[model samples]
Structures are given as C-alpha cells and as structure tokens.
Target: MEPFVLRGPEATLSTPTPADVDRVAEVCADPEIATWTTVPSPYSRADAEGFVTQMVADGWANDMMFTWAVRPPGEVDGPVLAMMGISRTVGAPGEDQAGEIGYWTAPDARGRGLTTAAARLAADWALDPEGLGLVRLQWQAYVGNWPSRRVAWKLGFRSEGTLRQFGLQRGVLRDSWMASLLPEDPREPVEPWPAEAPRP
Candidate 1:
C-alpha cells in the first residue's frame, strides 16, 4: 500500500520513515513511556529502526495495521510529538470490521494536546466510508493510564469496563480498561467530567 498522510488542525500524521529512527528511539527511551506502553524497556537505535523499517512497513503491506508519526504542522521534518495507529481486529462471523487504536506521546511533548488531536484525526479517517470503512474503533490501556483513557473519553468512546489481565506490559500481565466508538457516537465529549479524573 502506498503511504498516506492525514493533516489536521494541529498535527500531521504520516508514515514512519527510516530517518525517524533516532528520534523514535529517543522518545521511546523515556521511562514513563516504557512503563506505560509496550515499547522496549531499553529502547535502542536498532529497535527504533526495526519498528520503522520493518514492523511499520509490514503492517501497512499486509493491511493489518496503519501507523502514523505525528508531528506539528509545518514541522514534518522535525521530531515527532507522538505515534498513533489503528490495527485491524478479528470480528465474529458476519460482524462489521473493527480496529483497535493505540498511541504514545513524547515525554517532552506532553500537556499540549497534540496526541488527542492526532487521535481524533486518525479515528475520523478510519471511520470514514471512503477511508478504512471500519464499523467501530476499540481502545484499551492499562488500568491506570488515565491519559490514554481520557483521550478515549474525550473522543466519545463508550467505556466498556475492564478486562482482567487483558494486556502485557514489559512481560507482566496487566488489567486494562476498554472502550469503543462507533460511527454514530458523538465526536465531542458528551458526559460531565468526573471530578476524580486526572488531567490528560
């Protein structure tokens, strides 16, 4: 498949390239990102290269996933602010197609809402009939990943409760909070903010 790009008001989503390996490694090496995401614990230049030159390429070639390197508009050649993607999910027979979303923001880029804006762009594109044509989008994160959960909630994904031992982070089983968004769901937050929720 040819590389595609999605431009939004605040960010641009484009295919990962070999040139991005160094910056990708730098971002993934942050302990906070490693702890919260599945990125390699001791992220190396080699890992970053493999992710861009192999994993990202293969996923796009096989139509199994679509990843975007997120950068601020007019900064496409600069360091990435985040990485976001949607992966195809197996559905029951006769069910509409579905995809799962995941993302991680650079430590230095936190608090700017870049990831949230990029996510909304990705989700909207995936749900478009002229685009991926997916019927629903799924989101899941380790139970305490309030930042990720907040992104999902802000995009109007219905909280679907928790899944016991649903994911493995750094080889350890962890519970996950799951959510889903359908084509008909409002794109803006529809419910009152929970007082106890942490700021994303």
Candidate 2:
C-alpha cells in the first residue's frame, strides 16, 4: 500500500500528530462519542496519543489503513479539529479493495457539518484508483445513530443491511446499520449536510 492524500471542503486530511491527541481526546470524551462508536468510555489523552502512533505505524508496517486529522481548511499549521480514517481493506492484507470509514468531530465543532464534509471527502479519495485502489467504501453505525447514517447516505452510501449482535458497545451487544458507496457513482447528490435522506 502507498501513501495517499484526501481533502474535504472545509478540511484537509493528514496523518495525525502527537499534538493532535489532546483535541482528539476531547472529541472522544464527548457525551455523544460512546453513543455511536466503539470508542471506550473514559477516553484519555494517553489513549488518544497511542491511537495516533498505533494507527500510523499499522498503516505502514501492517498495511492496515491510514488515519488522518481533519483540520479546518486554510488553517494548515495547527492541531487538527477532528478525525476521519479509512481502512485499506476489510480484514486480510488485500482481497476486498474496500475501506471502512470512521470519524469524529470536536465538541466545539459539532453542528458545523464538519464530520459530514470530512466523510464525503474521504469517500471521494478512497474511491479514486490513484488513492486507495478501492472500488467501494463501507460505513457502519450503531442503530439509532441517525447522524452517522445520514452522513453515509449523504455521501452516496446505500443502506445495505444490518448486522445483529455485531459487536459489544458499552457492555451490550448492539445491532449496526451497514451501507456502501460504490466507485461508479462518485457524485454525491447533496452537499454534505447534517440532516436529510439520500437523494434518489
């Protein structure tokens, strides 16, 4: 796997730096974090910084995937305000040519459509052959996480199915909604927004 670049309408994607862990930890500590993600409760700066180191090293040594900090557009020299990442493939080294998208926005950045725009930007890049050599992007969200699913649909992911007892979250087995965006249809009907359904 090779390094790739992805950019959002309001943010640019880059490997997360240690300095970014503080802000990222704050985002992870948001009350909304555990509601939608597998992120652990009581998120700490150590956990945050470790993720940066681990994710980057994994991307290179294990060819797992790349993670990036999403910084506000035109403000390229500060700590990232959010995070968005994509896996290189499903499980093994290489088989599916598909990637899983995940993201989180800072508490102060909520309601600004940051994550939505960032997700769209990631999908666009991953679907490009020059980028991840991906043919599809998969998104999964906990049931009732309308915000997350909305971003996926806005970015052209079709609700494909649901995974029952998929995994544990906050000590409970939960159902997850799954969706996909194919490379063939790269144009998102709606500009990335916080609410609404996928345009037919």
Model 1 agreement with the true structure over 1-200: per-residue lDDT tens digits: 56698898799899889889999999999988887889888999999999999999999998878999998885666678899999889664356789999999998888888988999999998888778878999998887887887888889888878899989887699998888888888997776643135657
Candidate 2, pairs of clashing residues: none
lDDT (Cα, 0-100) at 173 in candidate 2: 89
lDDT per residue for candidate 2 within 83-200, as digits (tens), equals 7878866544355577788887777777787878878777877788776668778888777777777677767777768899875787898998887788887456433433454456
Highest lDDT, which number?
A: 1
Off by over 4 Å in 1: 91-95, 192-200
Question: TM-scores for all candidates?
Answer: 0.92, 0.84
For model 1 the local lDDT of residue 169 reads: 82
Q: Which ten residues in a row have the lowest lDDT in candidate 2?
A: 189-198
- For every model shown, the clashing-pair count is 0, 0
